[model samples]
Target: MTGGGAAGLVGLVLVSHSAAVAGSVAELARDLAGAGRLAPVEPAGGTRDGGLGTSAELIAAAAGRANRGAGVAILADLGSAVLTVRALLAEEDALPPLARLVDAPLLEGAVAATLAASTGADLDAVTAAAEEARHYRTS
Candidate 1:
């Protein structure tokens, strides 16, 4: 529910060890991109017990929610979050079709990927946008 209800736009899944952190990041990215300027974004963070850790089930569910028929781009925080995503990717039929794990800064990368997806870019383009954010200069 982050976009203008635009159909076919690529979606985003934000993964983090802390549920609060993931949710807040998604909110911030949505606000930064502005309403109707992004596709569906889902946050899958922490464990079912509200503990600080990664959950594969949560990640899969988020990816499913984020999907809009176009594709899904996943951004994970460092450490086991990334490892969880990688493990999910390795399994057959683990993730939704066209869903991919993006290696980039959690905050900046999500914003970039969300902006790119808002333009109806494909999965590859959105992933590329997030990956490209790794080189963004903060100076």
Candidate 2:
């Protein structure tokens, strides 16, 4: 709703426990963008924030705005990001609709989500890609 023009496609966010993860994703997105890959990626982590999830909320807001009227998808790291997002959505009702949860190749999912989103990929497509690439251990 607020930043789609700059992002160019689906508003994508890299959610992680460590700020570095998010930062790296953003850097990667920028690099990809420079390579004419132009994807809208935002990093939500410790490096960009000291507040408890303020960064996440910030990312969500930007994503929501960027999605325009379309909903935004959030690709998170580990299981923590999902919880954090749920908590955020519970606390803030204004958050955009989360198309799906990405359970896959962490970094790969982030990069994929960004790239796919940048190209106007739907939530299902990217989330499916993330899930398809996911390799979490399950007992």
Candidate 3:
């Protein structure tokens, strides 16, 4: 989806209250992932009206696009964003079975997940990588 041979790689979705934040984070994660092939990374932030809020519909749509058959990993900025993603997943049973909601630091988790996905990691691995990012400390 993202890299030329990334069709089988797991996808990632960054959720935030601000569209700009999501886009910026996605870019940073992509850069951190380096040249290896990576699955699609979609940003689902803000409401359709461009306000600061999360939308279940937008998240669901982004998940659909990111999940290029493999699976999707979601990283959220706040409680509301996480709640929105959870509601969408619960309501939409058609979403890919591999799709998973990860509780991790937004930027760190995105970077870790992107890197893992670029390496063609499976959904569980990618999610685990993201969750592990929470313990990453920069000294």
Q: What is the lDDT of residue 54 in candidate 2?
A: 34
Q: Which RMSD values do the candidates have, in order? A: 3.0, 5.0, 2.8
TM-score, candidate 3, is 0.91
Query: 1 or 2, which is superior by TM-score?
Result: 1
Task: Residues 10-109, candidate 2: write the lDDT tens digits.
Answer: 5566677767666787787566546553555666664244643335555565566546334466667666667876676675455666534456565767
Deviating ranges (above 4 Å) for candidate 3: 1-4
lDDT of 3 by residue, 25-84 (tens): 999999878765756889999999999999887788888889877789999999999888
Model 1, residue 12: what's the lDDT? 95
TM-score of each: 0.91, 0.68, 0.91
The number of clashing residue pairs in model 2 is 7
* Cα error, candidate 2, residue 127 (Å): 1.3
Instruction: Report residue 52 deviation for candidate 3 (angstroms).
Output: 0.2
Counting clashing residue pairs in each candidate, in order, gives 0, 7, 0
- Which tens-of-lDDT digit does each residue in 57-81 have in candidate 1? 9999999888887889999997899
Ranking by lDDT: 1, 3, 2
